[model samples]
Target: MPGARLTHEDRGRIAAWLADGLGYAEIGRRLGRPTSTISREVARNGAPVAYLADDAQQAAGHRARRRKPRPSATTSDGQPTEVVRGFVDEFATLLAATGLPRMTARVFVCLLTADAAGLTAAELVRRLQVSPASVSKSIGYLEAMALAVRQPAPGGRRERYRIDDDVWLRAWQADTGAHREIAVAAQRGIKIFGAGTTAGTRLGRMGQFFARLSEQMGGSTLAEPVGYDALTVLAALVHAGRPLTLDTLATALDWPRDRLTAALDAIQLHPAIADPLVLRTTEPETYTITTRPDRLGPAQRQALEDPGHVR
Candidate 1:
């Protein structure tokens, strides 16, 4: 019975046991199921105080229907089913645990597993069985986070939601930037509270941690699998062995001034997380980068190599 699912009758028994003020173990013993199964069911449905037999049964039925294999998603048994549906479902749940909203994670995972052709809003609605508004919310969240990119369909009439091949990289960048922002907030706290106080000490440590992470990630651009345009600018800086002014760097690269500026802005943010890989000073407005990630430990080196390190 450890692997058995609870039936409506079993749910009734649980409700009765709950009414009797019995614990989760006693309820599971009476139902011929493991205590963890009972606990999981109640936790998934609602908290113990508000648990209802009917509600739990209904929720269970709903989940089973959701897990039903569709023609498009065939299981290994050769039955028509949703391929990797359980993986995506469980992955979304895991992301939710990491602070991604349940619906947003579901939407992200949906687009992630969908074909390279991507899915339009209507298609998402039909597949997820959610409303247009829900699709909008989920897509909006992902777009804001730079995880999902929306493109016009071939007909140019509808927009398709797609998780790009660079989704993990973009997600990593965005998550790491969030840490930098958190560190900035901690720095602000230090200013608000006296630096000598306990609160100030905690804030100082918080800022240092995030700043170190940011630095390590920033330096990762030099590691293997580093081909992004921004890193090209850094490579140039490292080769020069001396700080180059923005105007000079732009002139040498034959890149637009705005492009150089944007690249520098992105690079400078890394200093908050760790040692400044790219340093820009107002006194001369020059840029400097020295390749040093090779000297870092394996953990630090891997963090640079992994695009999803922060997330």
Candidate 2:
């Protein structure tokens, strides 16, 4: 079974079990589920004093809506799989191993799996079936780790939090930064602990290693392609003198169609493209890089490469 569905009736039974002062394991025996599952279910949705069946059902419904899409199963397999939920459960378990609070880990994991591309603090509370205070604390913890970021909602909408492409990269950077700071502190500790002592010698070694690590990371370059790769494609398109179609662009780049589409979308967002390469057709979607160099100036082309200069 993928999982047993908890009905309003089941919630009432759970309440009765609690009233009888039965432990979660005993309750699970009666309910035919794992004790840990029952404990998590009640702890997440039940009230402080009681598990109101109606309220619990409502909360569960909301949570179900927020979950990642489930895969279909058939008689051929003879087993149903809630792969998304399984992955999320494993992710939560991994976070718990890292010493993160279970509730905090679950909340952040939900954000990672959400399909809306982002969520606000309020949405997180609704989706996680958690308290506002709990959601706020979880968000603060994630932000401190640099695992999440806040962004303005599109078209002057509410402030929202999102997991972007740079989210994991920034988190790694923050972790390294912490190590660098600790190294500096260790050096100071060596002086305080007395340079003649064994403890001082160990601390000094730690300081040296981290200082070297920090330097190496600083000098290392990311594998990101320079604007030259993108410019090369644009340069060829300009010389070809015909509106470049999406299919042609994909073939020329020798990359997947989805990747090419993403690139095209990013390029279309560029103000330089908006001014110089007007969309001639969108169905067989084609773009022409205007030959008028004066109109599409070098400054504008450079601006397209710099996101900071997206005026």
Candidate 3:
């Protein structure tokens, strides 16, 4: 009788309790398991329409049998590891507080942790421990909000979904654009509160400033030689001193993989550049300036202007 699982009656009762909108703690009290254990068991096995006790028990057993250890592989004193975890925990909490679905928040958080090189749906399924259906639905939610995107992976049949630098830029710009959209609404608020009054004038000014700033930012994004999104990813990779694959670079740049790949190829074809800058890998190619590159800095700079110039 030891370690006996919940019975059929217990499951139906839990289902009834959930239907009645009882919280997990309340259910735990009734079932004599810890709240988290109850939560996990239900999360692993039960769906909205069905919460069969026998099925849940069997599912839990199967999971325990097959579960793999997900070790925290990042080492201590690794600043990126710490920073990434901070970003993940903070964003996940914020998204939940904002009433976004948990899965949707998770997808966004994944992209953020990657610093704009978003994951593929397959990656999402593996990392988030969610079903394909949930990932699909969550991605749709993200896409509708323009918070996520899909881009091609290098040398691959599968497309990798991503959140580029522009996602945040667009969100900021959208907020700024809203200032112009509902000026009438602001005016109405102004009138109700009295236009000349301090609060109303402040509201009116806010609308004006936002409208102006949005236009400036939008133009800046367009005029910049490199997309701000791409720049950000490059900065992160360089800062981390990590080797970057073409897909990683492409995702970060928000450029097509082929375009960046072609650029790298051009650089390599020029023995001047390739001799100094080493390609890290070829399959999903990456490059980094070798010690040789450091030594050739002056020559490389001159060669930038003169194609034949490599000393």
Candidate 4:
């Protein structure tokens, strides 16, 4: 009951308390909630003077309904019922939101949720109630992304399209490959624009960001390269200017302990990062950033050793 959502009755009480000129802290104390919770509730529901119990309750109901998925229904023959169709459409809408073509998203969802044997083009057309051309075109798009594949149907000339077990893994790899290509193109732009120009500098940063992103995403097959997460951890340590324990890094980064641990491990192993800046384990689980003593190359070290040295 302590963490349960505030009810309509709670809203009524909040309205009454506000009308009586009660402060958020006082209201929260009476309601057994944190002051911040009470403040946010009141602020979102038109704050103190304008807040109404009935209006707030109705608005909250609408928000809750929108957050939840529609209830699913099934038919006796294992065919999708109207409710199922509606849910599929809703899911397709969400997929379309992520830059996918609407028809392609709809077709992909059908293949993803279909039976193991998969669906023929005619079956897909009937289920989706769309044109054959649309289904064919969408299937083409799905195939290009490695999200779906065509296989020969049993005892028939026609082919069936289905999502494979490794479809999502393949899709992820495809995305990472695309990122690598973009990074390469950006690097080309930097060379063409000349490194000293502002455009080249901007392209260089973009190239590095995409390259790092691609490396992070594709690092499962290769050696784990220093990624965005590891870089972020190093930045946090540098900014802190003091040793920070695992718990402190977790709290500051708002990341899980396991994720932070992985990033810290990556920072320790990356050779490129080992030269100029070292991630030192000062305490058992505490870390600090410090300069590496042998950071300079042989020539640079010699130059530093002898102040008057010249090439």
State which candidate has the highest TM-score: 1
- Residue 241 lDDT in candidate 3: 79
Off by over 4 Å in 3: 1-90, 115-117, 184-311
Candidate order by TM-score, decreasing, is 1, 4, 2, 3
What is the C-alpha lDDT profile of model 3 across 1-311, one tens digit per residue?
00125555667677788788888888865553346655775777766356666787677577668988664545233545444545654577678678776556766787766634557788766555456776788788888777878878889888778877778877766655565566556767787888789989887776555544544444444423334433344354556576777777777668786666555554443323333234445344655443443345576668876967644
Give residue 260's lDDT in candidate 2 (0 to 100). Answer: 60
Q: What tens digits encode model 1's per-residue C-alpha lDDT throughout 1-311?
A: 12235679878878888878999978765553446778888899788888899998898888989995754755334544344545565777788889887667777887887888888999776655555776798899989999999888997799888988988888788877888898899999999997999999999888988877866665565433322446767778778988888888999999888877766665565443224453546347687765444346689878878978856
List model 4 lDDT by residue over 1-311, tens digit each. Answer: 11236788989999999999999988875664557778889888996999999999899899898896876546445664665566667788798789887767778887877888889999877776666877888899999999999999999899999999998789889988998899999999988999889999898888877876675567553343436788789899999999999999999999999999988877665524433678899889999998764445688878877979954
lDDT of 2 by residue, 1-311 (tens): 11336777888888878887888978765553457667887888865266677788899999989999866742222433345445555687688679876656766786787655587777766554456776678778888888877788787677677777778777767766877897899889998998879999889878867765654453232223423344555665777778778778778778677766654554443323333343234346676565334345598878987899996
Which regions of candidate 1 are displaced past 4 Å?
Answer: 1-79, 223-311
RMSD of 3: 20.8
TM-score of 4: 0.50
Q: What RMSD does model 2 have?
A: 20.3
Residue 252 displacement (Å), model 1: 26
lDDT of 3: 0.61
Candidate number with the higher TM-score (1 or 2): 1
